[model samples]
Target: MFFSKQWITGAGLALALLGGTPAWSADPAATTTAAPVAAAAAAAPAAAASAPASLDARVQDLKGDVIRLNRDLLVLEEELLFPASTQVALFVSMDVGKLFELDSVQIKLDDKLVTNYLYTPLEVQALHRGGVQRIYLGNLKAGKHEIVAFFTGKGPHERDYKRGTTIKFDKSTEPKYIELRIKDSQAKLQPEFEVKVWQ
Candidate 1:
């Protein structure tokens, strides 16, 4: 008595078979009302099973595209290292006051430590009033560079910071200083960065 849509349809088919219903009747004169009902009743559950399988296949296809995008971002990061002077820009923002502080910036070349700054920590009032900070890395050789930026303020919240956006410099004239900002108390910030080559 385990009655379900699937089980009910299956039972109906079993009964039809046991009664010797010809699945394909060539007899042009033989006609019955049971045949059409049997066909439709068999189709409903089969359609239900087919729909979920098709949907699952589509979802898996989308996941494959997402995985490819992540791989592309990785490749872009690797491509950024080489010698060049260029313009670099970084936009940083925070969600809360505590996460915003001054003088927490560092730049590294090819994993070798280049320079870092100890910024003056701003008061909560100052940040709310809108403060901006900029750092400049000038005359870089064509190679890979890493910039690490974060607040040096004491606390677990202060440890959160943005990773360096890697860059490769060719001969060109671009801006040097990058501008980054920290917004509010969310203990997290992402700085937008741009780099260009200089002649």
Candidate 2:
């Protein structure tokens, strides 16, 4: 009921390759004529050669169809699971993170732990390079909600540092987006944590 695109494509190609071309016969009288028989014999090899090419084209067409189908399925699944009316997404980003070496993040929604994500060095570098990572996506009722985030890492002077930030926002029928940002404070020579709610 839920076969992946890769599995379906592989199985379809295997079936096509195994189903060889059917055999055809010419009438005995037709074969008796030298000119007609010679023509038919010459065309036979050409047809055989073209058969594989035709099958290959068909397999390529099927692959395209599978790719489109997979994309559609993912869109449908996301809509069903997290409708726009109640969807809430949280993202994490860093800006000029020279004072912090991020290690992990913990998020709490309405005082309940929602996510605790540990970051690898590559992921930290990506954030430093302006890549925004979606840390959570789920459904929340249309009302006021609170979110708390804790950022743990090494701060200026290579000292262990942890900071917590919180935000209270109201959600409407439209989707809600919240971004947790980490930035270096040049004036204070430390890392700053902020929560930005996007309208």
Best by TM-score: 2
Q: What stretches of model 1 exceed 4 Å from their correct place?
A: 1-96, 100-103, 121-128, 142-144, 155-172, 184-199
TM-score of 2: 0.75
Cα RMSD for candidates in order? 16.1, 18.0
Best by lDDT: 2
lDDT of 2 by residue, 1-199 (tens): 7889788667766754875221222345433565676799999999999999999999999999999999999999989999999999999999999999999999999999999999999999999999999999999999999999999999988999999999999989999999999998999998999989898
Across residues 1-199, which tens digit of lDDT does each residue of candidate 1 receive? Answer: 5568777667667856787544444454434766687899999999999999999999999999999999997767534542234544443333344443443556555465656665444543444466444445345544444555444333335654443445543333443444444434333443233343322
Distance from true location, Cα of 186 in model 2, Å: 1.8
